[model samples]
Target: MYSTDRRERTQIQQLTSFVKAWSQIDPATAPFLGTWTAWEETKSIYPSSVKGRVCIIDGFIPNENNIGFRFGQGTVSNGRIKTDSYILIHQGNYLGGVFVYNNEPGIYEYAWPKPLKNPAELMRRVPQSDRHRNHILEQFQNAGCTASRPNRR
Candidate 1:
């Protein structure tokens, strides 16, 4: 409605695509979702492009009730996707340390992100480990997250 290219479109397309991808989970890894879940919903309050796709390599792990920690967003263009963060927090550890990873795709290859440092120590230790991860989840919820199918238990 506005211009062909705008900021709102990017946000909508990115969020929608993210929710879709997150809904389609790996059956094998579904049971042990610690933090790497991306359950979300997206809306176009202003109008944005929904043609392209959004791909999340690694970052935050969201669960049915936990949003987990995330640092950045991914790039959505021409139905292709890429990440914007060098390191992403996939999940959290009991020690309040997050499992950090890097999804450095080279030359548009289907290269998955590797664990740069799993259980990366957090700046503030969490007396209750679940609380640390829950904090992140709440942030996304406050962002007016859209509803998606639960990926994990």
Candidate 2:
């Protein structure tokens, strides 16, 4: 399908870039990849103004959601995924954030995009994220999500 305007084009490009980066995540961090919605409590505190937002980092452009211009690019590391924000506006001005996987609580806390009082104060995966993450795990190999998840939960 053809993009009818510049915004749509940019969105498509962002999704394309997102897919490329996400597919390479090392298996250990693969479980964190999915759609996420900010918990009600985090909305006001989130610097990105992500309150009431459903974030889909599933590497594919969603037909109904928008993740804006920011996308993730990072390597899978021990207990955390260090991600650099692929920002288009102020290129090198901001620091990248880290996503820490809390296995016991079954949550992923993202720190930064600007560090607040609580360093890891960002996002709690909702049902959509759970479903999407599980789907990715199930079809990881076929979906080209390169990383082979090794029971990191």
Candidate 3:
């Protein structure tokens, strides 16, 4: 079993490596690493479904409240990347997963889509507490995006 620190370190390394490789590619081919959000949501666990060891790195982009982008990277399920799809857990209580590129051997390039015309549109639709709101704002700030008051809402 991998320790939490080890798992986190591995994830960070993978993310760093992915970003580096992505940067090397032309802007037209590669996606921009714009103002986005991330979180360490899953814990390291061994699963019977998977033949070997595995770890889940689950989180959403733009922010936690906006959309769900479940990304997993580990040697599991007979050394396969086991996951159905990127669950869009925004619209419905249980939005069906969309089959994103599955278990590709190379590094995963998960990039955020372009910003919406009205950022507050997402915030207004989702039900968020004050703490969640502030946390999301902090994430935006960390990504170098200024968070303005939701005057449009």
TM-score of every candidate: 0.27, 0.24, 0.24
Q: For each candidate, how many residue pairs have backbone atoms clashing (under 3 Å)? A: 9, 0, 0
Q: How much is 139 displaced in model 1, in angstroms?
A: 2.4
Ranking by TM-score: 1, 3, 2
Candidate 2's error at 110, in angstroms? Answer: 7.1
After the best TM-score superposition of candidate 1, give how far the Cα of residue 84 lies from its true spot, in angstroms.
2.5
In model 1, the runs with Cα more than 4 Å from the true position are 1-71, 86-127, 147-153
Per-residue lDDT tens digits for candidate 3, residues 62-142, read: 464544322232332222333444322212111112344655433232222222212233344444454554554444434
> Which sections of candidate 2 miss by over 4 Å?
1-26, 40-67, 85-153
The candidate with the higher TM-score, 1 or 2, is: 1
lDDT assessment of candidate 1: 0.29
Error of 2 at 47 (Å): 26
> Candidate 3 at residue 128, lDDT?
46
Residue 4 in model 3: lDDT: 25
Q: Candidate 1, 55: how far from true, in Å?
A: 9.0
Error of 2 at 116 (Å): 28
Predicted model with the maximum TM-score: 1
